[model samples]
Structure formats: structure tokens, C-alpha cells
Target: MTPAPRGSVRQWLAARPVAAGYILAVGSALSYGTAQFVARIAVTRVAPPLVTTAFALLFGALFLLPLGIGHFRRARRAPGKAWLFIVLAGLTAASGVAFMYSAFSLVPLVVASPLGSVYPLVAIGLTHLFLQRLERVTPRLVAGAALVVAGVVLVVVGSA
Candidate 1:
């Protein structure tokens, strides 16, 4: 089939939230795929899992330091009640990264990556339960969640 015109593609991207989300999702998946390969290589050289985990955490924190510093400075002026949420968010993020690295060391990427990819289903379920007033639980979301679960099952069985 002939590709859609460039202007039509641009218009669709501009108009559709789902389209934008899909683009970001693809980009993130590609980066994560590359990261898993790099993690595998790093683990071969570094005997300890913490060594690779520390390096990844340190560099990621360093890269985000400027934004963190700016936010801190702003918070200092008008210290908001959101500080608790911010701290929790940081902890949650750090924990996820550490666990992901630890899992990478223990399991092959084929298994670890699929396990991690199941997070979206978890998120969808949580949102449906907690934020039901904001987001209606529709058939489409249920179908997507089912597909994610099915994909995870396939990945786990195949990896085994």
C-alpha cells in the first residue's frame, strides 16, 4: 500500500493524542531494547550487579541534576505541599531502576524485558480502579490490557 502523504501524517500526529502516545511508546521501547543489550554486555564485564546499577543510577541522576536543582530552588521560594509526592516519586523511580538492573543480571533479556513491559497493564488497572472518575473503563482499554497480558504470557513461555 502507498504511504499516506507527509502532510496527512503530520496532521494526524497533531490531532490525535493516541497517535502521539504511540510514537512516544515506540521510541521508549526502542531505547529500552538498546539498554537491555548494553546491560547484558556490562554484566559480562562487571561481576557485581550493583556496580552496573550504581553507574546507571549515577549517570541518570547527573543528567537530571540541572532540572532537579532548578525545581529545588523554586520550591525553596514557595515550598509546596507536593514535596512529599516529589520525594516518593524519586524513591519509586530509583527503586524501579535498581530492580530492573538487578533483574537483568539474574535473568536473560528475553524474560526480563517482557516482565518489565507488563507494567503498562498494571498502570492501566491501577488507573481504572483509582481514577475511575477521570477515566472511564471502556472496552478498548480492556482489550489493550488483555493483549498486554497475552503478550507477557507468550514471552514468558517462549523464554522458558
Candidate 2:
């Protein structure tokens, strides 16, 4: 098919930014999911899980360090407790990633991968407990969370 004119293409994208945004969001999710599968595959070939985890963390930090400098400067003046909490979060994330890597090495990806995604449920619970003011719980939201948990349960049980 002949290509649409460049101006027409730009107009089309601008006219439907919501659609474009959704496509971009899905694309990002697709890329991250593929990375997880690739990580699972890589761990199978490489014996050391921590090495892969360390390298992945190092590379991600190095790549994003520059972009975060502005935020770092802003955060420096925030309350000291906030900085401590951020440090705790960083430690928690690193521990979680390393454990996930180790889990991928020990268990089937089908198991580790789906169970790893249970964080959404955890997030919902945590938000309800700690961030109640930020994220109010509603019937619809509860129903949606229930559906997601049910789906995960089905997948886990079916795979067994």
C-alpha cells in the first residue's frame, strides 16, 4: 500500500493521542515481559544468579543515573525520613529482584513469572493499609482486584 502523506500521518497521531498513548503503554509492557522471559532463559544457561542480578542492576542504575540527578537534587532537601524510606525501598527492590532471579533459576518460569506478578494484589492491600488517603477503595476496584486474583489462581492451578 502506498504510504500516507507525512503530514496526514502526524495529524492522525495527534488526533488520537489516547490511542497512541495506549499503544505505547502496551508496547512498553510487551518489552518488559519479553525481558523477563529472556532473563528466565538466561538464568538457565548461566549458573550464577547473583551475577546476572548484579549486572542488570548495575546497568539499569548507570543508564538511568543521569536522568535521576534532577530528582535527586530535589529530594536532597526533603525530610531526612523520606530519604531513609527511599533507601529502604531501594534495598527492598534489590532484594526482591535478586530473589526473583534466584527463583527463576530454581522454578519453572511459568511458576515464578506469574507468581511474581502477584505484586498488584500486594499493592492493593498495601495501599488500602498505608495509602488509604491516596487511593480510596471502592466496590468496582475491589471487584477488579478479585477478578485478577482469580485469574492468577486459575493459571496457577491449571498449570499444576
Instruction: Give lDDT tens digits, candidate 1, residues 31-103.
Output: 7889778887687666566688788778878988886785776777655567776788788877776777778
Candidate 1 weakest ten by summed lDDT: 1-10
Question: Which residue segments of model 2 deviate by more than 4 Å?
Answer: 1-28
Q: What is the TM-score of candidate 2?
A: 0.78
lDDT of 2: 0.82
lDDT of 2 by residue, 1-160 (tens): 3344567766766777887687688997897688678778778896577888898889889988998887876888899899898999999888887888899898888877787877778778888899988888788888998987888888788878
Candidate 2 backbone clash number: 0
Model 1 spans with C-alpha error above 4 angstroms: 1-23, 67-80
Give the Cα RMSD of candidate 2: 4.7
Which candidate should be chosen as best, given TM-score against the real structure? 2
